[model samples]
Target: MGLLDLKAPSQAGTMTEATGQSSALDPGTPQWSVFGQLTSPVTHPWAIVGETILLPLIAVSLGLWLNPDDPLWVHASFPWAWFAPVVLALRYGPLTGIGGAAMLLLVWLALNLVHPAEFPKLFFLGGLILVMVIGEFSSLWLARARRAEAIQRYLDQRLEFLTHQYYLLRLSHDRLEQDLISRPMAMRDALGAMRNHIATEQMDSDSAGASALLRLLAQYCQLEVAALHYLVDERLQTTAIATLGNTSPLQADDPLIEHAMQTGHLCHIAQSLNQSEQSSRYLIAAPLNNLDGECFGLLLVEQMPFFSLQDETLQTINLLLGYYADSLSMHALAAQIRRKEPDCPPEFAFELQRLWHIRQSSQVSSVVVALEIQSRPGMPDVAQQIQRQKRALDENWLIQDVDRSILATLMPLSGQSAAEGYLSRLEMWAHQKSGQTLAELGIFGHILPLDTDPPLALLQRLNEIAHASAQTRPLRPHA
Candidate 1:
């Protein structure tokens, strides 16, 4: 998560380098120099032991060389030999500083054997107290430093992710500007047309709309030579069902195709295959995958103008292919759901299925709120007010009857909390508009999660509840 692991920004000389905290500093790696190792908290235990044993010994030897009569430096203006233990405590911690002081004690014992001098208890005791105090300060700062480093690492990763997203956004904006000048229709329009085409045409098999998908890719991607192949028995077929231009035979073992299949994402020439492998003959290969990670087909672009083979262009192709795959899957799912519940609106069923797939793939949640309003003199007007206040992304299916009105609103990418918030808002708004709360008006709500139950079952339950509401009588005037 450090700056060292991040990809370099497009522009050079970032603030990380300006402050001299270069990205080359890897905290995990061992430092080479003894001082360097001591400065870092990641030093090895053996290294610490060696330094602890040697530092005091070196100081004693220097003291002996300077004044053999008082090698402990007790009589000197300053106790020079005690400085070693103090430094060790500042670098490591209290325990290490205590270890260094113990080594000095051992040295004093060994010297006493030779000279029979009195043990300097005051010298050793004072040194121990100072080392302990300094070690405590060191420990406090070390903890704060580690916490700061962790925070900095997290910030670095978030900044890197945002930088990459910004770069992609800029590229997409450029692509949009170019498309506005060159293309006659918007990308959303093209996707809508493709969706409509798939919905209207018969999709008896997996390869039902392969030709239309190829034509759409050709028109948008300017693919000079490309082919789309269907998947059979969990494998991509060797034969191309639809080709844009004069295309060669499909290579089932192509590296790009194999990578796309393995990763279930688009793989292009720019991506690094293994270092041992050579360049692939195709420019790009992408799997036509739905939101649930199901691959129905593969797209291979053999040739395109050099100028058009950009990150933005490849992203556009990937998006279009994914959209097509999802459309096919949605059409099939919607048909199955509609077959089970005839009264469910086509738009409501299709969106519910799509949201279910999204939940399975991305873990995003969606909620369905079913409101049953008993038929009364003023209830129809309340339903109209609620319908007008629907969120932009919400899809509603209103079923009106002589005895009751059922309004089912599908809130996409929302959970139970969002559903509760929405109901609360509706309650307040309805009270303000109708001068009475929803409960007083005989309006009840049931929250159904798209993920908790299958789409068909959720729709069926909503309908069953509506039917039950029809048999009930309206609320009388409140006492």
Candidate 2:
């Protein structure tokens, strides 16, 4: 269509109506305000000042128009006309107040220009100066109040952030106390007593280990029904070595028992769990492994009166099972180490020697972190994972307890910051695993600095923690 061509008349109204609708909805448009003349977005510094000048001018015009015969003095000194100047000065500072006052003065002068002698210049100017002074005082206080409000909002946000951080820290500390301080003491005592009982006489057979484990669980955990079963004949058959209560069908090579044995995770079957199902006649079956995480036995228990699988109770049970597993693994590894006298891996031995020399020559600090991965597949996989995730300075090692379940890393000079870096990486790795890898897998670690102890003592400490709980060992310093 030609540039000047117009739509039909009916179409012209539609276009105009459409334009009006769009203009109304457009966010860029400013609304009119009688008080301000125009209300602009906050980005404009002069919008509010415009209100100050316009409102007073309009008031004076109205007052003059309404009473044409009123005295010139009364018209110029209209009380309502002062409202704009006073408010502008209080909110927009003194320059705006002065502008508003000048605008009002011009209104008076314009109306009585023909009679200068009758004009009340001194009276009007004096009153305006006093009003401006009062506005300045009010403005000073308003500025301070606004600044104070901003600061209060900033502080409130900071306080809220700190409160959230503190709450998370408290939860972490409480978990540590429960795992390290309280439960470990009881666990150590029970395991020690079991060791003494078994060591009192010769008990090398699978039957003897089972009896002792049952005893430990009974005495410490107060379990009335449980059994320990191990595989024999090249892992081809299942054998029940001990029993606390009447043997349930779980004593056989049920797939559930085998599943727990293989994964080293705990299984509780009401007929199985978390429906809130499986009911009251459920069973709790946990796998017992040696240091290498080879499922050596299945620990089966028909549900008992006191046996609710809460976190605390489950943790205690796992700790006991772990301690039991570690004891057997420790004995076997000690025998193997004594018989073969294997030195630390060449790389590990070199790192330890270098650190020891540095400690002697200068103020050097080194630490050993033993991470026991639960139901972790094999040393090669664990080694590969650590190798990929480890820091440049970190010297990772897999101390395969004879059964091959525990993994420990010897860090030459890891301080608190370095240690946390490794841990956060490990935490990330744990979270990535889903189906089988995540089934019962857990990573537990402990750190011992060489600041006080020699390299040898630190190694021994790492070995000690290597066999503790494979899921809850704390990375606190050791003496």
Which regions of candidate 2 are displaced past 4 Å? 1-187, 196-206, 232-237, 248-255, 261-263, 271-282, 290-292, 306-309, 337-479
lDDT of 2 by residue, 244-295 (tens): 8776644355555554554446655532433233243435677664323455
Every candidate's lDDT: 0.72, 0.55
Task: Provide the lDDT at 407 for model 2.
Answer: 54
For model 2 the local lDDT of residue 338 reads: 29
TM-scores for every candidate against the unseen true structure: 0.50, 0.31
Top lDDT hit: 1
Lowest lDDT block of 10, candidate 2: 15-24
Indicate the residue-level lDDT of 47 in model 2: 68
User: What residue pairs are clashing in model 2?
Assistant: 270-278, 271-278, 291-405, 292-403, 292-404, 292-405
Predicted structure with the largest TM-score when compared to the true one: 1
